[model samples]
Target: MKVHFILHSFNASCMDHNTLKFCVFLILVGLLVNISFAKNDFENCKRVVKVWADSSLDKEIGEDNHKLRDLLFFLHIPRTGGRTYFQCFLKKLYPGYLECPRSYDKLRFDPRKKKCRLLVTHDDYSMISKLPRQRTSVVTILRDPIDRVFSTYEFSIEVAARFLVHPNLTSVTQMTKRLRSKTKGISTLDIWPWKYLVPWMREDLFARRDARYSRGLNTTESNDSYDMEDFAMPLKEYINHPASGDIVHNGATFQVAGLTNNSYIAEAHEVRHCVQKYKILGKFVLQVAKKRLDDMLYVGLTEDHRESATMFANVVGAQVISQLNAANSSLDIGDKIEQRSFPDSDPHSSEHQNSTSDRGASKVTSSESGETAELNITVGELMNSYEGCISNLRTSYSGRRIASLKRISPVNFSREARLQVSEEVLQEIRSLNDLDIELYEYARAIFYRQHKTTLQTFTEERWNNIPSIVYGITLWKVLPLAITCVFLLFLFLVIVNVRRRTLKIKMKVMKS
Candidate 1:
């Protein structure tokens, strides 16, 4: 009996030890899971904050009306630092107010009836005009027309090369040579102009439905909830037709090539009928169909006085950067740090991968001419540029038109405002010193260059009550750990209960 008792005691001790080991294993697993989740969340949060560091985040800048509603238009110029800005602003201030559409078409269609605080896309003014922008701030960044064209070309070639579409043209120089080549047998697919122009010509720019000629366009049907980064397609397809330009099909679509008697042509167009419309007839014919189609004449922020352009840019940057800094600071992105360093420069190579360097190099340069030609953009410019243009039309752009003057007040954007915006954010942007001094040069270069500019003079009244939009990475990270702990705790309790019950049964058997 003593020997049997000793054996039973040893067995029980061994069982208890095994049970303890199992519980410890569960706990270890739980901790690992939790830590994994927390780390993921932390990274996500940092990503969100980093996005705002880009100057492009101001794409969603707007004001809340007395009705307590948000209204803003999003300008998504891909690879234009727009992603970072939108993500940061949405995460920090806008929260539920903004939507980033993967493709411009789906975003427009889905939100046709829905009023939103912010709507951003690579879409054109025509598509955005359909949105309720009566009280919203409509804004977009324009790159130097030449650089914009260059980027579009480069991006297209990269896509084409990936699919092995163009064999002879592997690099930009080679592609340029191939493009300029007068080969008679060259297929439209083999050349740039043909490939770029085919879709535009094939598609009925005026037709609401997709044309059979353009059947080779973006093969994917519209998806309401597509994410841009995850989207993929053949390189040939992306460049052949951009979805942003697809807004031509929407109700407010601008007919770039329409044959109507009454038409508004973009200032960029050189057609006799078009130039006559703006310069001669002055009828205010709608060319770029947008929310305020009649009002959007390319206006220079200042009367051909060059200094105003620089000041305007700084003000815009200051406003945007200040808000972004506050937003970046509010997030508790648990402990990951961003790798903040400029990329190395590559001078010998034609196409380099350093995003920062590429951005720096693309700043606008003046043509041989000393002054840049003004586009008929802002009404403020119309009033200032041509004598008696605004008074003759008796028209006013919808926004609070900064009065027409050769020189704008530089005093408004104070030094204090610039200091409030983070120097770190400013570090990301290409400095204005590298760009042409003209308004168009600065505007276009700033828009295209990939960098973060600080907004030192942001108005507290605009974003006062808004909570920083945090990336949900922390919740994602900690959730795993929490789940593991809870699961382990539950398992431990169950084990204890089972052991007690088993012991009670054994004792009863022994007594019996």
Candidate 2:
């Protein structure tokens, strides 16, 4: 009986051991399952960790339903935050879902049509509207107009000077003059390529006289053929054709076209245009685009005015939500954006510059690979990504400006530059030396003319109407002249008094 009890006791001990081992095995299996699920469910997009990635963090923040995959109609301005949004946020998060092709064609993310998900491009609002309902969500970023303008101008100057073999686009003066020959140097003028491109490409605007095939033609001959149904229109007629001008002016609002010449007119015209274009269907969208446009379309933007941009993004709804959420959450993503960035000095670094402007496929492959690994970023890299997005959105359409300035690299300014830049500006301005037209008036007129307004109109309205200093001197020129005259008068008085005293002293000595 005692032996029987001992065997039973041993059996009981074995049973307990087996029970413990089973529990341990189950726990291990559970952990592996959880890890696998985490890997599949959570995605690192735009180098930004989403709010839903960590359950504990999500619980703390009270964020739910984080996987509301949105349709993004990203209004990507060249240097704006679009690239960062695409590279770091959208690509990884959506994977094959987001339709942002690395090209100049507007992306369409059609889930059902797996042919091509992302459409890479440099298209405007009209194209953005074509995106599918479920696959596309629209959002855009804007910069302060003044800063945007300057950046666009600088970047255009940089790019043209760097990669493209530009002919006659030598200096800022030459750029302005060349642009003026076709269209004024308006604010939105930088966005229109046909004006400068057709001339620069030297593709005889008279080459193709096919109207039916003129959908995207940038020349008059192409349009004339369509209208005439025959190519009998004079070359000069075709050259100065409205269709050619329309190619430059189409899609651009009147204000954008007129901005370089008239702020008031440009603003008024653009505001009116926004009202007319979006009045039928895109009321909310137009309002958002216009509100954002006001910030970048008129003058330009500076770096400090970035907050206004954030707020601007918020008004556009769902698309902005992802951008904003990504921006806010990425603060903890390690050092992505650093102050001492090597990318700043080396424009060749894909991290800071967009590769779409010049070098083609090889450059794109290298560039994509560089930023592809940004999913594991530090805070510095995230910030850099954010700034890069803003830069791209602003400068995307201004490729000529990019080509002109060589924004990515330092260009050698040799007299051997290809563009045929002229020496003089105009005949009237050069002949105005005799009027001593208030230098202010002359300056204002010059600026106004560039903005697309006539000098006579600007002078009559603003400067000419001002009470002239009867001596016809501008305050800028007059102030210096007045100071000189006062000094000369004082010197003459001092010299005459000294001479009289000396003469009196000599006479007294003679009498003595």
Candidate 3:
């Protein structure tokens, strides 16, 4: 009897241990299954959000009656398609209010002209704060920082080349001349014919060197004599220089955060704080940014310029016309031709003739008549000479001729060239623009969330239009729950069957 009791106790102990082990295993399996289901559910949610967003976007294709009472302030970040936005869309849409000032001090709002609806500027964060919050609606476009920096460099080079080859005018002197001309009273830079071509006139011009140095230096030079103490030296040496403090480092972040001068360093924490005022909350919260972003009238993206332009038109209560396309077509060839022909068409024009005598008089001592004629060469011929200079520089610096500017697409050249950058150099760029990278990521996240929220609202608004059966079932919300409940029931049944089988075996042994 004693032996049987001890054996029974031991068997019971073993059974309890086995049951506990099985329970633990089941618990682990349940946890894993739940995690997997949760992951899948999250992905499904994202897909639903995307679908809803797309549907909402489709509805907004030709939307109307979007005019608002507030003044639109477009914060134009350099090299981020400001030219395209202003030239192709905004200028036509708001001709009365297209004010592009070089600096914050120069930006003037006419209290008398309440129709002043728009102000586009390269002025940084502080400018927005100065405006009446109730009346001002800020809108801006952002780009990949690395790409923006490269584009800035290339654009600076091109503008410098145009300046050097034609008349070798300093940006300040040229601006002074313009200010002295009849166009002096004009508030906006766009009034000038060369408005789009003279981005170098801005005080915050990113390029530090002349066109020759910018185009001629080899960035990858292994020369031992060259100094590498300054970060910007490499950029001056090579066209493909990686990101550094001297270049347009954290340019997007600085611009968005309202830091005007490049002298300011981009500290991540400080930037987060600075942008917080514009954000929904005064803390580092992405949700705040998302909310604020949704409140904006329009946020354009350069990559999606056409669609953005349409959206912009809708917001301003303007008719989307074929003028933009026509304008772009004309700009592509017309502007270049005009710029080249301007000097030649009227070599004896008062503007050139007056300046030529003062500057060319000294250089003309060798051959007076020949020098004067040479100075009167058409822009095309001048550009050819410039190209020859660039070619020679390229050969001297890199031991090979670089691609002609005409062959490269201005918008896409930097993007395509960046892929060819070495991994080490790429890493250096990433490190230099860490704050920009963070800010960009944050902005993107907020943008997506805003997009999702917009879609969700649209979806809810259109809920009644959905078929009764689909609406009644609320399939998107109910399907997952239904599947989960069914799975749990199946699992419960299996557990009950296993328990019953174990109990029956124990009873049979006891009975025997």
Q: Indicate which candidate wins on lDDT.
A: 3
lDDT of each: 0.33, 0.35, 0.44
Order of candidates by TM-score, top first? Answer: 3, 2, 1
Which scores higher on lDDT, 2 or 3?
3
Worst 10 residues of 1 by lDDT: 404-413
- After TM-score superposition, the amount by which residue 481's alpha carbon in candidate 3 deviates from its true location, in angstroms, is 46
Model 1: per-residue Cα lDDT over 1-512, one tens digit each:
43345445555755777676655555565566667765675555444333322221233233432121234554433333333333322222232212322222222334432433455544444343355545544444333332333234333333332322222223434765664474322232332222443333222221211232245433334231111111222222332344422221111122211211212223222232332322221112222222122122121222222332333333332333344344335533321111111112222221111112222111112223232111212323322322232232224311112231101111112224334433442332222111112323434333323122223223453365345433434788878999999999999999999999999999999999
TM-score of each: 0.28, 0.29, 0.43
The per-candidate count of clashes, in order, stands at 29, 94, 2
lDDT, residue 353, model 2: 30
lDDT of 3 by residue, 194-307 (tens): 143234323222243343256774242332211221112233333233223423666665555444343222342343333322322222323323333445555656565444
Better by lDDT, candidate 3 or 1? 3
Task: List residue ranges in candidate 2 displaced over 4 A.
Answer: 1-69, 78-97, 102-120, 146-158, 162-381, 384-512
Q: Residue 111 deviation, candidate 2, in Å? A: 8.7
